[model samples]
Target: MALLALSKCYYLGNLDQKVFLNEIKEIIHFHQEHHNLTRLAYQSAWELLIYTLIGEKFYEQVIVIELHFVRETRRELEELSKCVDWKRKKVEREKETKEVIVLMRWLNSLEFFFRFCSFWNEEFVGLFGNVVQLFRASSGNHREIRGECIDFFREAAGNKIMKVEGLLKGGAIDAVLEEISQQSLNEDNKICCFSFFLELSERLQEEKEDEKEEAKRKVFDKMEEEGLDDCIIMFHHFLLEEELPFSYPDENLECYFMPL
Candidate 1:
């Protein structure tokens, strides 16, 4: 309840700015010490913290705070997949559902934060890797969060502002592309995977011919080896049928979309 109230203060700018920031840092520190990752209450409070920080326009501060516990936080998120008993009654699953929702909201806030903040350095590479882990863990449950994970990949991979070198170092491309090859994912995730391929294909178009060919070769070779060469055609059809989610679809992908 205090965290929620603090969020309002932070958003409304009702408190002294430095004091509020320090209090936020202290509050998160307290939560980290007191809240076990398995508890829905912990997840809820953590989500509110992220919400408050982003609402207060403290994106860099949030990044710094999260980076401090990135590995632990990621492990907690991945553990969510294991802790839930899906066969339990709906009433029993309520807590798990709420935890997933809170985590998803936290991830959504991170995605929004990254949009306005440039991540060009090695310090920010963990965020990219966390997204990949979250993507893998969000599978089989929490479809909405899984979709949001793919949305992050699409944005990060497609956006020119995002540095390719950093993403590569973080293994975002290989991880996501490997996920695209997996057959067990749900339909929403499949669509998202296809969308990621389309966005990546279009992004590569901006590179010089030789660089683009080398990159495409690497991506296509991986896809082909995985027996998902058809995904290339499927993504192209999505563009042609106007099913892709991009606001502005690239028209030059037909050449690349040709059978490999």
Candidate 2:
């Protein structure tokens, strides 16, 4: 299986590449093994985290790379969402379905990476939306990944090349911000969430400045109608005093993440 081969590389790759690949690697990072799977795969829980991100240019390349990831990661997240009563097979099926959600998060990162590359794939945008549907408050990883996706899109709100039109058009931002407020006040990720909302607020300022008055007015009016003031207040309540990490737009994006 492509999974077995990739697992070898994933577990044994040079430190540089291992660190590089870890960012977009899904939590369902590999297929199941018989032994102590989690420990064997990740001795340090923090090691499982995504830190440094790698961006690419072309949609086709993103697709190919992500498909490879799927081939390798296909085994762990299979469960059925359709079953009312927990049938044995249904449990098995939704576990698989969970992988689909994980894959969408991976794709979301790829789409962001491609903001540096020339290739654009509309399917990835659509894929991101599909993954959000599977986000349930019951699942921990799902909740985490969904938050990360929200942060990613919030940053992407002003992206010139590929704004997630569906999200912006459909009001997903408000829905997710509301969800974030309802979540447990887990302190670990609070800083990250605060940073993301700040980024969104910054983008809103930019929209007010760059776009026409009518568009800006409409945006503000929409925010008012949808309880965005309360959401913004919620964001401020969560904000910490620490400095947020600032990442500037890549000016020389034509080459860096572009497919070779």
Candidate 3:
């Protein structure tokens, strides 16, 4: 509750910039050292971190090195990832499921923060490699984690903050496309995967005309190698076979649809 209230105050501009940065640094430190925060606490901490970064004050402080938010956050994420044994059996990992989900959420939030803030420095760019590693470590049976991983990829690819080539080279394309190819994914996740491909294509279009064709060829070559075309065909077939809530009228020309 205190974290939520603090986030509210920060959002309202009631908190001093120095104080808020200090608070954020402390929170990041705590998270780095502690891996047993409750789910609600993690949610509140995530909200607080979002509020901290959404404002310009944090960015200004970061630029002048008043705060080590980026470096600290990277360390926190590294420590958090260490707490989860992704290779363990499902039964063994059941106790850590909540932490795993929290980790994914943090990754999504950090990716968004970096993208929105345009933090494209070497320090920030290095984090994308970590995102790919976590995504690769994720179990195929953990749909929620994989879904969030897909979201991180979509956000990373949709924006100009991170180069598409870097992401592709970091194995993001392979990890995401492999997950999308899983036969057990539901329709919603399949749609999310499709959006990632679309965003990737859009990002590629942003390249210079001279280099655009080659970049597209390389990305599409990787996609084809991962069987993305087959996945799209399968998703299309699934959509076609899905039943609609309302049916069309026959040739009798009578209106059969009714509004709720």
Leading candidate by TM-score: 3
| lDDT ranking, best first | 3, 1, 2
Per-residue lDDT of model 1, residues 1-260, tens digit only: 55444444435644454555565556556767775334444444444455445434355456455535455456555666465443455454535565566566556655654554443336557777777776665555545665687777766766655666677777777777777677676656666666667766656555444574587668767878899968877755654676323344556645434432
Candidate 3, residues 8-95, lDDT tens digits: the string is 5544654455666666666655765785555546556655656556536445355324445556555656766787766676666536
Residue 171 error, candidate 1, Å: 3.7
- What lDDT score is found at residue 87 in candidate 2? 26
Question: Is candidate 1 or 3 superior in TM-score?
Answer: 3
- Candidate 2 at 210: error in angstroms? 5.4
> What are the clash counts of all predictions, listed in order?
0, 13, 0
Better of 2 and 3 by lDDT: 3
What's the distance in Å from true for residue 252, model 3?
31
lDDT score at residue 197, model 3, on the 0-100 scale:
73
Off by over 4 Å in 1: 5-19, 32-62, 65-72, 75-82, 85-95, 158-161, 178-260
The residue ranges of model 3 lying beyond 4 angstroms of the native Cα positions read 4-19, 22-47, 55-66, 85-98, 209-260
Q: Native-vs-model 1 lDDT?
A: 0.58
- What do the candidate models score in CA lDDT, each in turn? 0.58, 0.42, 0.62
Could you tell me how far off, in angstroms, the CA of residue 191 lies in candidate 1 after the best superposition? 5.9
TM-score for candidate 3, please give it.
Answer: 0.60
Q: 4-26, model 2: which lDDT tens digit per residue?
A: 23433425533454453444244
Superposition-based RMSD of candidate 2 using all C-alpha atoms, in angstroms = 16.5
